[model samples]
Target: MPTKKELLTNPIQHIDIKQHNVVPLVDAMANMAYSSRDLNRAAKIYEMMLLDKDCGVILCLAGSLISAGLKQIFVDLIRNNMVDAIVSTGANIVDQDFFEALGFKHWIASEEYKYGAHDADLRDLAIDRIYDTFIDEDELRICDDTTKIIADSLEPRAYSSREFIHAMGAYLVKNGKTPANGGADSIVLAAYEKNVPIFCPAFSDCSAGFGLVAHQHHRSAAGKPMVAIDSAKDFYELTKIKLENPVTGLLMVGGGVPKNFAQDIVVAAEVLLGDDADVAMHKYAIQITVADSRDGALSGSTLKEASSWGKVDLAWEQMVYAEATMALPLITGYAFHKEAHAARTGKNFATMLEPVTA
Candidate 1:
C-alpha cells in the first residue's frame, strides 16, 4: 500500500475563470445548436439579470462543485458583485469551501481509483473521495473541531444557517484566514466582505453537523446551553430578500435543496405578502444539471414546470441539461468577460436583512 502522502500529493488546483476570457468562445457557441445554444441563451439571460438594476441574482449551488475546482469562480462572482446572494448545500459551504479556508486542500484522485475500486484502501488511509477529488479525513476532523470551537464561543441560541455562516466569516477574519490576511480567498470570506448572505437549509448534513453534534452532546452532559441551527430562519431570511427585492434571478448549478430553496422563496414571498399574485415570480432563471427530468425529482424538474407552482417565470427561464462544470464557467465567463456586471451594483441584501436576522 502506498503511503498517505503519496496518495494525496497532487492538490486540486482551482479553476480561475479570470485567467481565461471565454467571452468570444461563448458568443461563438450562441450560433451552435443543442446544448450549446441553450448555454448561450442561459449566459445571455444571466447578463440580463446583471444589467437589471432592480434584479437580485441568487446563486444556488448543489453537488460537489468547490472540490471539483470551481471555488475561484464563485469567489470571483462574489467579488465582482455578479451574485447578490447564495443558497448552497452544507457540504459545499462547510466541508469544501470552509475546509479549504482552513488551509487544507482537496487532492486529485487518479481515474483508476474513482469507481469504489480503491475506496476501502482510501478509507483505511484516512482519505475520503468525492468522485475525482480526495480529501484528508484527518484534516476534515480539524474542520469539525473548528466548528465546535466556534459553536462553543457563541451564545446558546438557535441561529439560522446564515447567521452561523456569518459567524464563520467573522471567525476567518479574526483568525486571519482570509485573502487579505495572506490566506486563501474563500466563498465564506467573500460573502462576508461583500455583505452577501449565504443560506444552507440543510446545514447539519455536513462536517459542521458532526461538530454541532459533538458540541450539543458536550453541552447537554454539562447541563449547559448549546447553539442550534434553525432551518426555518434560513427560509424566512431568504424569503425576505425576495419580498424586499421583488425582481430576482436564479443561476442554479445542479439541484437539490439549494435549487428548491431558492425557487420556493418566490412562493414564500407571495405567501408572506398575503398571497400577492402580482408579487412576481423570479424574473429570470437558469439551471444547469445532468439529471434527467424523467426521474420526477426536484433536480430534474423543468423551469417551465416550476412556473406551474408559481416559482419561476417560463419566459426568461432555461434548463441547460448539462453538467455544472461544463456549463457554469461558460455562462459565468461570458457574463464576466463581456462586462455584464458593469452596470450592476449588488443589492447588498445581507446588509438589508441584517437587522431582522440579527
Candidate 2:
C-alpha cells in the first residue's frame, strides 16, 4: 500500500488564463458546429458584456471547480474587472479557495485511487476525495477551526455570507495570509481587494459550517450570543444589486443554487420594487454544463426556460453543454486575450451596497 504522503505528492496547479491566449482557437470555433459554436457565441457575449459599461456581470459558480484547478481563473476575473459579483457554492469559497489561502492544497488523485480502489485506505489516512481531487482531512479541520476563530472574534449577530466572506478576507490580510505576505493569492483575497461581493446562498454547507457549529455550541454552553448566517439577508442584498443596476449579465458554470439564485434575482427585483420598478431582465447570459435538461434538473434547465419566468433574456443567451473545466478557460481566456476588460472599470458593486447592509 502506498503511503498517504506518496499518494498526495502532486498538488493540483490552478490554470492561469493569462498564460494561454485562446483568442484564435475560440474564434476558429465560431465557424464550427454544436457546443463549440455555442461556446464561441458565449465568449463573444461575455466580451460584449465587458464592453457595455452599463452591464454588471455576475459570475455564478457551482460544483467542485476550485478543487478541480480553476481557482486562479476566478481570481483573474475579479482582478481584471471581468466579474462584478460572484455567487458560488460554499465549498468553492470555503473548503477550496479559503483553504488554499490558509496555505493548504488539493492534490490530484492517482488513476488507481480515482476508481475507489483505495477509498477505505484513504479514509484511514485522513484523506478526503472530491472526484479525482484529494484534500488532507487534518488540514481541513484547521480550516474549520480558523473559521470558528473568525466567528468568535465577530459580534454575535446574523450575517450575510458576503459579510462573513469579507471578514475572512480581513482575516487573511491581518494574518499576512496574502500574496504580499508571500502566501498564495486566493478568490476571497482578490475579490476583497477588488471590492467584489461573494454570496454563497447555502452558506453553512461547507467547512465554515463546521466552524460555525462549533462556535455556536461553545457560545450556547457558555450562555452567550453567537453569530449566525442570514440566508434571507443574502437573497435581499443580491436582489438589491439587481434593483440598483438595471442592466446585468450572467456567466454561470454548472447550476443549482448559484445559478437559480442569480437568475431569481430578476424576479426578486420585480417583487421588491413593485410593478412601477421597470427592471429589465439580464441583458446577456451564458451557462457551461454537461447536465442534460431531460432530467428536469435545475442545473440542466436552459436559459429559455428562465425567460419564461422573466428571469433571463433570450435574445443573447446560449447554453454550452460542456464541463466547466473545459469550457471556462476557453470562454474567459478568449475574452482576456481580446482585451475586453480593458475598456471597462469594475462596478465595485459591493461598495454600492455598503450603506444598505450597514
Candidate 3:
C-alpha cells in the first residue's frame, strides 16, 4: 500500500456558486424534459422562497454533502440570508463542517482505491472513506475530543442540539477557527453568526456521540453531573419556528431525519395551537433525491404524500428525482445569480428560542 501522505495529498475543493452564475443554464432547463424540467421548477420555487419576505426557508441536509465538497454552497446560502434555519444530520455539522473548521481537510480518494476495493487497506491506514472522499481517522479522533472539551466546559444540563451547536460555533470563534481568522468558512460558524438555528435531532449519532460517551463515562466516574442532549427540546424549539413563522419553505437535499424533522414541525405546531388546523403547512418545498418512492421509505416519499399528513402543501411542492451534487449547485446558483437573496434579510431564529430575562 502507498504511504498515507501520498493518498491524502489532494484535498477536496468546495464549489463556489457565487463565482459561477447558473441562472441562464437553469433557465434553459425549463425547456428540457424529464428531471431537468422538474429541477428547473424546483430552482424557481427556491427563488420564490427567497423573494417572499414572510417565508422562512429551512434547508435540510441528510447526506455526506460537506465532505463531498458542497460546504461552500451551504456557507454562501447562510451568509446570503437565503436559508433561515437548518435541520441536518450530526455528521454533516460535526464530523464534516466543524471538523474542517479546525483546519483539517477531506481528501479526494484515488479512483483505484474507491468502491470498496481498498477498504481493508484503508482501515489499516486509519483512513475513513465516504464514497469517493477520504478523511483521516486520526484527525476525526481529534474532532471527537474537541466535542468532549466543549461539553466539559458547559454547565451540566440538557441542551437542545441547536444550543449545543451554537456552543460549537462559539468555541470556533473563541479559538479563531473562523474565516476572518484565516480558517475555513463553516456551516456552524455561519449559522451562529447569522443567528440562524441549526437542529440535529439525532445529534448523538455522529462524532458528538463518541465524545459525549467519553464525557459521560468520565463525569459519572467522578460523581459529577454530565451534559446531555435533550432530543425533545430540539423538537419543541423547531416546532416553535413553525408557530412563530407560519409561512415556511423547505429545500431538502436527500432525506432522512432532517427531512422528517422539518416536516413534522407543522403538525407539531398544530398540536400545540389547537386541533382545528391552526398551523400552516410548509408553503413551498423541494426535495432532490435518487431514492425510489416505491420502496415506501420516508426519504423518497412524495411531498404530495406529506400534504396528506398535513406537513407540506401540494400546490408549491416538487420532488426532483436527481442526485444532490448534480442538482444543488445549479438550483442554488440559479437563485444566487438572480440575486433573489439580496432582497432578503436574515431571520434571527436562534434568538427567538432563547430564554427571556426579566
Mark the regions of model 3 whose C-alpha exceeds 4 Å error after superposition. Answer: 355-358
Q: Give the TM-score (vs. native) of candidate 2.
A: 0.98
**Deviating ranges (above 4 Å) for candidate 1:** 355-358
Location of the lowest summed lDDT over 10 successive residues in candidate 2: 349-358
TM-score of every prediction relative to native: 0.98, 0.98, 0.98
Task: List the global CA lDDT of all models.
Answer: 0.92, 0.94, 0.93
Model 1 Cα lDDT, one tens digit per residue, 244-272:
88999999999999999999988888787
46: Cα error in model 2, Å: 0.6
Residue pair clashes in candidate 3: none
Query: What's the TM for model 3?
Result: 0.98
What candidate 2 gets wrong by more than 4 Å, as runs, is 355-358
Displacement of the residue 260 alpha carbon in candidate 3, Å: 0.5
